[model samples]
Target: MNFDLTEERQMLQDTLRRYLRDKYTTSVRNEIIDSDTGLSDSIWAELAELGVLGALFTEEQGGFGGAGFDIAVVFEELGRAGVVEPVLDSVLMGGRLLAAAGKSDMVEEVIAGALHLAVAHGEPGGRYDLDHVHTQADGDTLTGRKAVVMNAEAADHLIVSARDGDAIGLYLVAQGAPGLTIQGYPLLAGGRAAEVTLDKTPATPLGLTLADYEAVNTLALVAISAEALGAMETATALTKDYLMTRKQFGRPIGTFQALAHRMSDLLIELEQVRSAVINAAGNLEAHDRDLHLSATKNLIGRAGRLVAEEAIQMHGGIAMTQEYELAHIAKRIIMADHRFGDTDYHLERFIALSAA
Candidate 1:
């Protein structure tokens, strides 16, 4: 399928790019990063005003009637601007999870820009296996722990993945639920994460079938792969700009054939990953999803790593400093590598799938 974006998609991308550049500043991101909330209310207000927070949902649910690609576009712009808000966890993951679970009552709250959402699915022991879950939910009560829960403090709701009578499922838990405790854990990329402990926390089952679970989880992975595209593009752009201005050997470094070729190779790899992302998103109901998603996630992880490393190299010592956002951008992608899924483990599964 052609990945050419439609006119609406183009418009949304352009609008978000402009908005991020104008409104979201390094200082603003720093403010949120330094605060307890780990979120900039003003920036979120701006996002809501720009319709970015609700850019990729249905009109009936107060969304902008956008697609996954549209959300990808917004993420790219945010990545370039070094947005600190948890757009992926709050809007994309949360919105999709709710919609998939047949929860429309929160749609207006979400779209009206009132509620932010997060997912607590990764356990401390690890979800790399994806099936060896240890969390438990019984009769509207849950008891478990999830780590690396992004934007947990800011989220109004959380979609907790847990096991119920030997069946892995999702639960929608109110942030204020009685037995739930959240402790902050910030990342190197200037965002607030947390370790969430649910001690018999109140929750409502998502009522998902086996097929639904598989599809939603795979789509979420693919969706995150799409977000990785954003960070990769920004890192590439930063590298390109750095090479353009920074002098080396008394000349613009980018003019050097060796560095130019390296940038070209990075660009090619990024394009290949982009193709893989598109293919993965399209192969939703294909016979072998584990293979498709694993390959896609692996490619995205590699592409993200390559772009970030090369960008840092091009930026020299300044890349690691707080002055430039490239370092933080790289860090976010690197950490994002472990979220939703891990590349090496998934690649092993992909190989196992292909072997059969």
Candidate 2:
């Protein structure tokens, strides 16, 4: 039960950490977020060249690695840097879905960072249910609305989920397809999301049926849980540093027994989240993957909320300001809970899975 990363993964971790540390500062990220597309083509290309994108898929999928650990490693780094790119949406979720559907051409473009893709699976009032799809597909035409479609505006293609008869199916919709409209806006954290409107839009079927859709959705949960762990680590470290440095009543606030105790609790929660993420990642391909994923996401949602609250409270007003790094990380943790499934949602799911 060793948690140590393999040499290749460790190297990938180091390389990605260095690249993001040098290039993804708050100011640079701000510029990217403020831009028309809210993305950096140069940085995206750099990530592709560094094999960050390739690491999320296997050789069979037109890349080098596609294991659960690979996805966890890449996304953890992305979370650490608070990167606003659509790598999670495009690579982890959409690219993997394409790979599973045997869409080698699109997966290759994704690995090469030549194109962006997003999954438009969520809809208004869906309430975190992956199969609660209202979008309908008939004869290669899709008609429905998808809510919070991350990176849709910047995507070259969208892997949209739709109801085909009684089963869920995935389709590929090209950018600016007829009768397709995207209303893009910034997320509370850093990236952009769109409300996608499809009015009998033409689409290409991806050959993925209901079972594949469920599997991909569950994998997405594990990926984001790992990402949330990275963000919580950053937030916790930032809070601890602030406590150790910020003077209060002629001494550092960290010297106070009350604050020190609180910090210790945060560290314990962080460790718990780390363990949950590891467990979920390891069991991602197992038969009972849904059980592990639900449990992991539930723990992540709860622990992430605790970390976000404690970090913000410890930092006072500074952590709430957008100009600081912890604020964004905190936002990421808080918002990640809402994505995939929140604490209550996963908790209920875990209970049902356990009972069955």
| Candidate 1 segments exceeding 4 Å error | 59-66, 209-213, 285-290
Error of 2 at 191 (Å): 1.1
Q: How far is candidate 2 from the true structure (C-alpha RMSD, Å)?
A: 1.2
TM-scores of all predicted structures? 0.90, 0.97
Best by lDDT: 2
Q: Compared with the true structure, what per-residue lDDT tens digits does model 2 show for residues 1-356?
A: 78999999999999999999999898898888888777899999999999999998888887887788888888888888888888888888889899888888878898889989988998998887777899999999999999999999899999998998898889999999999999999877877899999999999998888678677777678778888998998999999999999998999999999999999999999999888888988997798988999889989988899999999999999998777999889988999898888999989988999999
Candidate 1 C-alpha lDDT tens digits along 145-179: 89889989888888888888878888888888999
Q: Over the full model, what C-alpha lDDT does candidate 1 score relative to the true structure?
A: 0.78
Against the true structure, candidate 2 reaches a TM-score of 0.97
Q: Which ten residues in a row have the lowest lDDT in candidate 1?
A: 208-217
Q: List the residue pairs that clash in candidate 1.
A: none
Off by over 4 Å in 2: none
* Model 2: residue 143 alpha-carbon error in angstroms: 1.4
Output the lDDT of residue 314, model 2: 91
Q: Model 2 misses residue 329 by how many Å?
A: 0.7
